[model samples]
Target chain A: MEDRVKRIEKALDHFLPERKGSLSETVTDAMRYSLLNGGKRVRAVLTLAFCELCGGDEDMAMPFACAVEMVHAYSLIHDDLPCMDNDDMRRGKPSNHKFYGENYALLAGDGLLTKAFETALSSEAFRNVGMERAAYAAAVLARCAGEHGMVGGQCIDLATENRTVSLDELCEKDTGKTANLIMAACMMGCIAAGANETQINAAKEYALHIGLAFQIRDDILDVTGDAKELGKNIGVDAQNARCTYVSILGVEKAQALVDEHTEKALHALDAFDADSTFLHEFAEKLATRSK
Target chain B: MEDRVKRIEKALDHFLPERKGSLSETVTDAMRYSLLNGGKRVRAVLTLAFCELCGGDEDMAMPFACAVEMVHAYSLIHDDLPCMDNDDMRRGKPSNHKFYGENYALLAGDGLLTKAFETALSSEAFRNVGMERAAYAAAVLARCAGEHGMVGGQCIDLATENRTVSLDELCEKDTGKTANLIMAACMMGCIAAGANETQINAAKEYALHIGLAFQIRDDILDVTGDAKELGKNIGVDAQNARCTYVSILGVEKAQALVDEHTEKALHALDAFDADSTFLHEFAEKLATRSK
Candidate 1:
């Protein structure tokens, strides 16, 4: 991992203590189990990278970085619920439900989602950013996490289960379930950095493109990567009979779409004149990653 | 219902349009279904009343009111999930899961919760109020709804299922699950109305007492009231072996505690001016109600 990503992971660990000895011990435990589980720290790294691209300090973006991770963690937990994807594994270990049981997984997800907002609102750096932008950031996170974004996408994903999905339907599902929060993370980072509306819009465009590319890459990886490489069970999507970008479009077509999105994402970087190297390279790396 | 409450209900209806005209139609429909299931509208009414108490206009409190109800509605929807309470009914009708299916219910709850923050942050009324108070209200609501408050309480409640609980454990559960949001609602109302900290604290105290009293009353009513009046399967707690104050303290003792809490709630109201008649009476009514 990059030093910046490592720093964010360390900060997340420090900031999210177990809340030990509290009534929420179990919830805190489940949240920590998933959050602390080894991952790429991609969202937080992206958040900090975008903030830095806007000349914002990492310290100022810490809470949002943590919040982004919390949101991602919560989504994974919920996505693994019996009524949802019903997966038993994540990150090459037991999923949250596998460890904590289904109900705990649900509550843990709720706790993390709520905690993300609390963290964002209570952070001194966030407060120093002024309420208007903070509120904007908060709203963006909520929209992305909720029905209009991730939740909405998940709902459609469930609706399409065992059913063949057209390419357009699959794209829409990918946009909502996967792309929305990624886009929100980028936009939120910029908003926290006190970027202007134009800058924020550019960041959002970049996020949307990269977010979709990330999903497409995931679809490709599910078909091509080994179970160990992907950190979880392989061909789970096929086992579940779920449609994906790779399912609708062949692997080659999906790869082409990834290229298109990666280019679009880089185009969005053109609007910014700062140290864009990290963000641009990160977008490329995200789209081209094997896992 | 009071005229103001009716007005708020009407406003809630207008706020959530019932239509399925797009690809994301189901999500929008689920949100409307959960949010539009009419309740007492107590939270919104209190917000408006608090705004009025602080010399603010009803219009100024409208968004905050809707936001409160949305949060409340979302909680109920999720709480009714099969993995949670498995409740089939709420407000004397099929629960969100029962009507919309579990997936839709989950997204509906998520949608309502997220839309709530979005509405609060974007409301013209919130902008009219200073950002400080708006942020304060946002923080309070987030905390109340998160682990330390409602969600935490719920976690305990779930853990304690089918276990015999002592009075203290029951109190802790009720405090986290039921009373916390009530207290938050009152505090948010005061903050929205731009009340001083002293007034906010006083309102919180009143809300805390009333909230506990309300739950105790519920426990009492669960044992004593008819199913028709209660609109739920009363004695279901005994059937499920769920720990409740009534099961722990017995009916008469539970009533006595309710009386005590009612007195404390009334005493808390003494700090407020005598002109806050309806708010004070609402507490009394909540304590003494049969259902």
Candidate 2:
């Protein structure tokens, strides 16, 4: 797992825009700052793992993996803005807006988001995977990250702040806010590997379950986990009065739901003929994570 | 010109995401509100005109044309944020942040930027133009709109606000912030039409000169034009103590520069085999417009 993570990190560094000593160098520096900040890299790892599972070259999947990570990084930057979640810390360090001030941080987020598409579209991987598939993969990333996916989810989350919502509502919010990008990552990997509909659907299904489980686990950790271990302030959701699975269903029920979703995620892997031991362990680890 | 503007307007409306009565409806509405707001569809028109000049079907260029317009709209929304320009009016109406509030305005900007790529990558024109060309066109748009392009230009503008800079520095800033997108529009049109390198370079050169001319004209207008004619406040550069061509070179010299750039822009069109009467007139009109 550490080896895979190191590989993903190296690829992300390689794909980042260079820091030229030009007028716009500050924003580019901010983009690199937030993007290269240490995170789990789960989405990127899933992309590469799923591509290899579908008999595709991991090298071809690298671009998409880095692209997904970029989108995630941008979202984090925006979410931490003063008008959004107003977070001052992320990953045990100052949030982007805190580090670079609001203006450059905002531009940095915009830069990363635009850079994600630029990287994916210009990648040499398209020559190997075919442009049609490459275009489709990029479109999927856009849709998942755009109004109907992550951004939409963020809107809903903001609207529902300070209100206790039902389990179904929480699930709907989590699906958009969290699951959509995970699903995009998995589907893009499958598409890169030339997987047919059945395999693609299976990967998507797997992602949906694990994504939900991951969110629920996050909520649980916010309540019970240590802030140092989590690399961010805990109890933020409760302080903000934000709705979450743990908030709606209680910790025990949330834990049960995570286990259930983990099982479902593993079950979806049955369609793949290749050994998916890594994915199986990955799902369980995410469901039971401390942070 | 009016007929082309109407066509561009309809295409923009058609390409905008539908507003479903979902939790995310407000951001989508914000997107449409800002995007469909009455404004000169200059970039879109440039795209389609160049496509037609390159002997391609205008229908095939519609997607790229609309994509450029989307990027322009998103930039406006972000530029109006309280942290940025902090303007309350745009095109004679309240700015997006004033209309939809700051949070939705930010997400709307993000949604529009993402959707721009989605629209271009998923267009039926890709099938007609070949995936390779389509990908290249999308990459071009991304590059122009990303950190080294529009966003980078914005960063420079923000950093240098309230401070006077050299004419060369100002030119570099405007080229990135204003001319990069215009160049992308012309280049994408040429690419969509499968134009040769010579044709593509010519269109780029034309766009670069006109883009500079357009910015210089804008500075002149801000100083001498009426508010009603401009649809927004005039003398904003003076109000914010921002440095522009007019501030650096005086109005008479700035106007001279605009005329010079306009003539250079027209000269670049000499490379085209097809008649470029519209572009010739477009450059002249832009150089002399009151608003």
Candidate 3:
């Protein structure tokens, strides 16, 4: 792994606690379980990469990295709520509601979402960015996390239940529910490090392509990958008859689309002069990952 | 009625439909009823009062005013959930979950909480405050609404179930969950309008007293008031054996405490040269109001 990626991983590990000793033990545990489960920390890695690529300090981007991960984890918790997906397992273990009960799971998700910004605002990294930049970053995070962003996307996804949706519509749903927050993560790093508008826009573009590509790959994985490899139950989407890129485009065409998105993502990165070998390679590998 | 209070109510009615679409009809309608079913609009009114008092334009403070009300509504929704108070009625009508199913009620609460920020950020009022101020206000609102504020207080309250909590501990929980958000509303308005630290601090102090007094009066009302006047059911605290200020201090002592807090709230207004008559009288009247 690259040093920046390693740094993000290390920071995330350091940031999560086994217990906070509050009354919200089950909620905190649910947060810790998903957060610490050994995913690739893709969002944080991308944030660190983009911040470094923009000739900015990675130290200033660490909180943004953690914030993105917390938001991601919280989304996963809510997505698994009985009202939403009714899923029983996540990351190969009992889902939050399964273990914590529905009410605690709900509160836990809400707490994590709120805590992400609190963590971001209180970070030394934020102080380094100054109040204006910190505020800007918070606003960006809020927009992506709130209704017009991730939650809005979730609303659309829920609305599509038992209905056929076109490929464009699927992309629209994925863009908001999954892609927008990821894009916000990358953009937030740039904003936190005080990158120029040019750098920020380029990073945003890169994030948009990669985020969509990531979801497409996820759709592809759901259809073809084994549960052991994906760390999740495969074919669940097919069971739900949920419209996805894979469902609409077929596996072969979905693979092609991932490649096209990877190319587009790299194209956006071309604007940055700083080395982005890690980012470029990350995009390419996202297409090939089994999970 | 105050012009700003009327304006906030008008805006609440206007923005109510901006969020709901047809699909989530049950959940959306429940949210609408709780939000539109009139209360005093006290928190939003406080926000507007602080902004005008601090020499900030009310127009710039209005979106945030709406946001506070939304947050307040969300707290009520969650507080009345089955695992919590399980209140069937609020403001003399069926609570959100009582009309909607429990599951839909949960989602509706989530939807309203998410919409609060979206409404705030998307508003021209927020933009008028400048990005820096808006971001600060957003952060404040998030902290107040999230675990460290209202949600955290609820968690503690739940933990203290079926037991006696000391006056200090009860105060701490009530203050954090209830007063904290109200304080945030006042501070956020001042910050939104670019109030200096001195003005912000004064408003915060005033908010602290009123908020605690409000909760204390609530406990008192629970014991003394009837079902018709207070709306919802009466004597819920006694029925649930909940630990509240009145439960801990007894009715006479709680009433004395409310008076003390109300006087202190008014005294805090003395720090500012601006006409705080509405805010001062508002606090005093809030203490004695029936229903």
Candidate 4:
């Protein structure tokens, strides 16, 4: 996991614009400051792990992995905007909008999102994946992250704020908001490896299960985790009146859901011939994570 | 021109998500509101005209044309945010943020940008252009819109705000901010048609000239055109303390620059073997138009 994080970090540094460029220093600096702040690199790691498990070249997966992280980072930056989450702190430090004024922070987020595709499209590693597959994968990323997916989920979150939401509504939001990108990561790996449809479908199902499990654990942590370990103010969901797994089902039931989903995630991989020890361990860790 | 506008409108309607879909109604409504609002659709028109001139099927060009407009609309939406340009209206109507609030406005911009690529990638029309060409075209769009192009120009615009800058610096900023996308539209047309490198280069040069001219004319209009004529507030460049062609080089010199660039634009098209009469007329109209 540490090596995976390092690899993702190195690729990100190489892929992002150099700090010395003549472009807007403030925007680029803000972009770098947030992107390189060293999160868990979960999405990138998932991409690489899935690629390796499917017998694809890890080198070919690096660009897509980095691109996923960029998308994730961009989402976070926007999510923390005053007009959005209004978060002053993220990952234990000042949020993007807090650090760079709102204007620069907004443009910085746009820059990161645009750069993700530019990097993905221009990458030699991506070219090695073949244009057809690359286009397909790029399309997947766009669909999963755009209004139809994460953006839509965000809209629903705002629309339902301070309102009681049914479990079904919460599930719909969670699926769109969290599982889409994870599914994209797994699908991208399968595409890069030239995996068959069955393998791709299985991987997607695996991602959905683990993604739900991950989110459930996050909800649990929001109420119980310490601020320092959580790397931001905890109990934000409750304060926002967001309906979460823990809020809807309570902690014990939410934990049970996480366990069931994690088991299903591992079960989804039964069709694959390759060793998936890392993925299994990763899912377990995410399900039981403190932060 | 009216027919071209209608064609662009129809394509956009077909390509954008329906407002009644299950996705967050607010986000999609915001997207449709801003996108379908009666803007000039210049980028899409340029793409279609150039593609037809290059002997590509116009139907096949529609997807890329709509994508270009989506990008343009997204930029306008983001640029009008309170944190950015802070405009209250666009196209004689309430700006996205004014109507939807800043948060939804921000997400709507993101949704449009992401949808641009998704529409491009999923187009059966695009598939007929071939994967390598489609990928190449997509990369061109991203670069023109992303850090290396429009976003970079935006950065410079902000960085140089309230400061005097050289004409060269101003040109560089304009080149990145505006010309890049115009140039991209032309390049994508050529790419779709499988035009040779020289033809593609000529299209780019032509685009750059016209793009700069178009922007210079915009600066002139901002000061002289009525709010009703332009469908938004005028004289904003001076109010914002921003550097523009009209501000840096008075109206006379800015008008002179527009003429020079327009001529240069027509001259660059001499290398192409196509009926360029319409393009010639279009350039003259763009340079001389009141709004």
Q: Per-residue lDDT for A151-240 in model 1, tens only?
A: 778877877776898988888888898888887788888988889889989988998899889988998888898888888887877887
For residues B1-291, write the lDDT of model 4, one tens digit per residue.
898799889889888858575748899999999999988887887777777778887776777788888888889999999888889988989999999999899999999888888877765645668767777777788889987788888888888886898889899889988999999888887777778888788889989999999999999999988888888888788887777888779999999999999999999889778898988898899999898
DockQ, computed on Cα atoms, for candidate 3: 0.42
Worst 10 residues of 2 chain A by lDDT: A122-131
Error of 4 at B219 (Å): 0.7
Q: Which should have the higher lDDT, number 3 or number 4? A: 4
| Structural RMSD, model 4 | 1.4
Summarize candidate 3's per-residue lDDT along B1-291 as a digit string, tens digits: 566667888888776664555333444566677788787889998888898888888788888888889888877887788766788888888888788766556656666776676566654644678766766777788778777677777667766775788888788788877898899889988987798898888888888899999999988888887779888687888887788887678889998999999999898888778898889789989899777
TM-score of chain B of 2: 0.98
Per-residue alpha-carbon lDDT of candidate 2 for residues B1-291, written as tens digits (9 for 90 to 100): 788888878888887757787877888899999999977889989999999999998787888998899999999999999989899999999999999988889999999999898878765656657767778788889999998899999999987886779999899899999999999999999999999999999998999999999999999999999999899999899988889999989999999999999999999999998999999999999999987
Error of 1 at B192 (Å): 0.9
Q: After TM-score superposition, what is the CA distance of residue B250 in candidate 3 from its true location, in Å?
A: 3.0
Better of 2 and 4 by DockQ: 2
Give me candidate 1's TM-score against the actual structure: 0.96
For A214-270, candidate 4 gives per-residue lDDT tens digits of: 888889999989999889999899887788988889999999999999999999888
lDDT of each: 0.80, 0.90, 0.78, 0.85
A179-289: candidate 3 lDDT, tens digit per residue: 888888899888877888888888888888888898999999898888987778988898988888887889999999999988999898888887788888988998788
Model 1 score (lDDT): 0.80
**How much does candidate 2 score in TM-score?**
0.97
Question: Candidate 3 — which residues are off by over 4 angstroms?
Answer: A2-6, A9-30, A123-126, A196-199, B12-37, B92-94, B97-108, B118-127
